[model samples]
Target: MATVWSVTSPHPVHPLAWLAPHAARRRAAGLRRELRPRAADEPLLDLAGNDYLGLATDPRVIDGAVRAARTWGAGATGSRLVTGTTALHAELEAELAAFTGAEAALVFSSGYAANLGVLTALSGPDALIVSDAANHASLVDACRLSRARVVVVPHDDPDAVDAALAARTEARALVVTESVNSVDGGLAPLHALHGVCRGHGTLLVVDEAHGLGVVGPGGRGLLAEAGLAGADDVVATVTLSKALGSQGGAVLAPAAVVAHLVDTARSFIFDTGLAPASAGAALAALRVLGDEPRRPDAVLRAAAALAAAAGVPAPPSAVVAVVLGEPDVAVAAARRCAERGLRVGCFRPPSVPEGTSRLRLTARATLTEADVALVRGVLAEVLTLVAAP
Candidate 1:
């Protein structure tokens, strides 16, 4: 059936007339999204957000943001190259580099921007990019923007990456993968992939968005865990919004690579600097992670508990995915969970493959035994309800 238009414009058709049918298709497929504004003190147990360390509401982190706002105003005002660069941004960059063991770091407005900056600045028509099938959307978009020859290998298949790099015709090459798969919470084979990249003389760029605050010693990320941080041929992009409980992202690499991106990365050169408040919050969060190194372990433990409750394998990071096989079923399960006073993530098509829609439950260091029990009961009932005919 044709979608009816409610437009009253004089023109025969609106320029955006195609949007009606597109939206209709999405609604029919149970793929439409709705925004549910959260109350400041909503009393639901949260397992849906990416606050792996639960530092977003911490007093110290809040203080850091307040101080930054008082000292530097609200927004960055202009691009970093213009009037946006502040002493706080520089300090955060240096601290991030030191903490992650990178030679240097460059901050961007967001993790998406950081990925765009690095990929576009490092690769062009003459370069080949080998990307993992399960990489985050930002990296996928980055590859598209790079204008490079891109080949997507199977998820976590280092041999496929090796073959792709070995057969590439371009003089320059980059292998991009996420340290942890965002959908299934699977850890990538970093060491094996890095070895392949080294053999092929390719640079390895790992997105540590999910790993920085939830994996490795003191949450230094999977690269650091694999002893690959600061390697000459390796680069990493991390989001302060995740484990750091702040906003913005950064690229950590050799000094030369950082310098090149600073000069040529359009995403960084043209975008406004990260807000001073975000820089301060991220810095404070990093310090918290250092002072309380057990936080990451707590995250992993919480993830394990959630996974066990959901009947899934233990996750290596804070993301615990429960595959439910159908979008509607997953949505129903999530709704049931919410009704039972538990909030969990429901991922459907475009986020995960069709027929594999699932619940994406995240872990937080602050989750308690009582919290786990609630999750267990809610999940058990929800799963049973969904499984019934």
Candidate 2:
């Protein structure tokens, strides 16, 4: 008798298999995404990363990381609830809450995890989540994972959020939005949304990834600038990766909400704690920002200059998006800038909510006048090259 073996078919019969065709279409449209790592000593002028304050590699930040690593081990051994929580984590959380003017704060491994922890922990089957159409992918995924009735309202439209909440009479409601849109660098109408949420008795969660270091007095964040930081119904999630130039995130809210998350948020309970080094670095960066109040002004000026030179409108925050009219055009423009020793971000569909492809440039406080001139020149050449045909 011959031995028999079973073979499985590679193809699936479900409609989801059609995703291959969609992916191929995206490739044909030059919307394929790829990552290219930079060399440690790369000479290129970087305008792609979210290091708004240019402190990621600062000497003080590096020293903080070194000190923390020397004191604590490199990796957190377990989830924060178990053996992972350290004195550094507690100190960072306390300082962050005080700095952001919130009653309590919970740190997570990343901003994505922070969003997930907050949305999933606060909302459930009986909750209605009204989200902005232009929100980050993390928030969108959180809404989906929360098992809540999610209504995606028009981008930055407080009236739409109000109507959505008004229609949901009995459910616990959450209004979620980004303080500064990642793609276009446009500021959201946070004040108006706060009013809408207040009227509807809804909890408002603001993702301040881009707004923290570039907006408000002393770079406190959009919520602080809008005078909503300590509001009982409002919560904020922010990334330490951007302005803080670290590698973690934090959710700031009322003490009760923070306590609730510690008990109920699966992401917080199961995820490994943020590295001790990142916490120390972020704390040092925050202190530096507090001492040097003129950093945000420098970033804003650089952004304004770049926007004007690229023939794009100035961004309200530190990001300046240069529209290239089409997907292939945007890719080509970004490539040209890269070739010219300038690194810029290329945004296409899916990443861009409006489906308009553009080049996303992040302005840094450390960018000098000469660096700004180089950026202007490279952008001018790339735009001209793309526009020619």
Candidate 3:
């Protein structure tokens, strides 16, 4: 005989009570997160932010934001299909396409939305999506929401992608990958992936979120560096938040693909347009990149210095991950850095895999020699203390 379970409480239980145990479990696992807001002018040396080019505070960028706000108001006011499409948005889209060597471009409110828009709009039930195992969270979520058969191959493995594409029976196929791995700072083999994609007659989607303003010649992007930009079968997505030091995203693809996304992408169709201020700021950032072509080199050099200080391989992009192998250790190390007047990023699962929690240090083009030296000293000291028995 089986015993039947019954609620003994006379009143109804709280609907959110079930979340308490999960929160406790997270605490036990050292994965509970908290928000710590900073002041506008904190004295700490910041190495955790994604402002790769350090243009967020540039006078030109700020002026661009102000100008756009004055002209078009602070908000977009409506979706792109409605009243949200401003002249600034059109100009930004045109410039982005020209800079990245794409036939056209479509701006979104964020990089996440751009990923979601392109993936969901391009693939469907009868289509197959080949994704890299280490793709960003946005790409993973996009794959899940695409309603397509998704096969996640090993990270940076073109042969695995080729095999997956070869084995798929769907009439249409899409291969999505990140040009740079956001967590580990690994570079994808764009040329090889594109070759495999061409062989399979599949569309290649490269997320240049971490690569756009830090990789390629003159910060065009990884796709442009590989000579695949503007290819009819290729598409790229980028965020204005990272190296651009702005706040938006755009999809670079053939004109037809942009048209398709504008029509069919639910994220784009239902979501509000990118803010006018963000569009203006991004446009100004692009111009700054054009004028200051060496900014990307500065970022890479800083990343190399930081990686050497951490005794890790030089990262290909602005992100330098120093793995400490445990969430508590990473968190404690970050806290120690903070105590030492250095602010860095601490990432734990599910941001990274179990046992690979790390300090995610971002390099900025504006980092002075003194700043780098101080960072080196602090990293050496903190990492040494953490390694002590």
Candidate 4:
């Protein structure tokens, strides 16, 4: 016996129709982003990237990545707690903990994920999060996902943080901030903030993404430089992509915190582990940083030189922001830099406060005197051009 049936498929819907108005609004606001993939060998004076130690293209780092890929394949197959965790990942974690002077460490696939993982895991319905207004977007998202009461204090204001923390009725509070304000290139008052947190019985979480490659002795990072490393109450998260010129992030904290994260951090528990090549490259880069301790100093010197040439005060880390006042003006300045074969970063509204759009210049340890002079000269012209425009 046979049976016959008639079937029909439903009409499809346009999935992105609602995005048209949103995209139009963004365009009107001068916030539309365009992707421009860089060439492998673009000849330009570079200042946009966060390769603070200039290790991204180093022979040793490249060799390490190549060796790792050859040994462990190209991708991490599963989550960290599953088939993804490799010997390379474990070694990298150990080395990072030792280097940062933390009792223990955990690694994530990216710095953004690390921030999200740590903040969300540490905070809950019973906790409060006092965060700096100028922290990275990752931390902001983390706070939103934490399901904790979040109080955002003014940028670099430790007193405000203390006040927020003191006012909280929660049993647990976490004070979160960046070692260096990413956009403004301002250094945080970590010593004062830590003091405030300690007095309030709050734990401090510092993101050292920028500071790790360009600050402290031998690029051990600002927490270590501030003598706060390995402190039971302070935890630090650093990105391997910046100074190590690799990819991934690590959280350095007490052993208990590390263990707890291993058990409960959803991001780490579910996300694929960091690729072996990144782990290998990071380890090799760490060794390189140890051998070339002067690289961080070189980066700072370059930042100072860039700031001086721009007629601004020297920035604390490798980031130097040149305020251009308007989105179009900042866009013009960045365009001028590109015209002059200088690749610089252009950040507008949302990245910086409204009406304070600017060019973000990052210093690399390998930049030469000639490169510095060229950047200075080009930026001087850019400043004048934007001023008149």
**Considering lDDT, which of the candidate structures 1 and 4 is the better prediction for this target?**
1
Model 4, C-alpha of 363: deviation from truth (Å): 0.3
Give model 3's TM-score versus the native structure.
Answer: 0.97
**Of candidates 3 and 2, the better by TM-score:** 3
The lowest-lDDT stretch of 10 consecutive residues in candidate 4 is 4-13
Error of 2 at 219 (Å): 0.5
Q: Write the per-residue lDDT of candidate 2 for residues 1-389, one digit (tens) a residue.
A: 98464546575365476899998998998878887887999999999999999999999988888888888889778899997789999999998888888999999999999999999999999999999998999999999999999999999999889889889955699999999899888999988999999888899999999988789888889999999997899999999999999999999999999999999998899999999899889988988888898898888988999898789888889989887667888888888898998999988878874457899999999998899889878877878888885
CA lDDT scores, all candidates in order: 0.94, 0.90, 0.93, 0.90
List TM-scores for all candidates, in order: 0.96, 0.95, 0.97, 0.95
10 residues in a row with least lDDT, candidate 1: 3-12
Query: All predictions: root-mean-square deviation over Cα?
Result: 3.1, 2.8, 3.9, 4.2
lDDT of 1 by residue, 1-389 (tens): 98787878787696887999999999888788899999999989999999999999999999999999999999889998998889999999999999999999999999999999999999999999999988888999999999999999999999999899989999999999999888888889999999999999999999999999788778899999999989999999999998999999999999999999989999999999999999899999999998999999999999999999999899899999988898888888999999999999999989898999999999999999999999999999999999999
The 10-residue segment with the lowest total lDDT in model 2? 3-12
lDDT of model number 4: 0.90
Better of 3 and 4 by lDDT: 3
Once model 4 is optimally superposed onto the true structure by TM-score, how far is the C-alpha of residue 31 displaced, in angstroms? 0.8
Could you give candidate 3's per-residue lDDT for residues 197-307 as a string of tens digits? 999999999999999889999888888888988999999999999988999899999999999999999889898999989999999999999899999999999999889
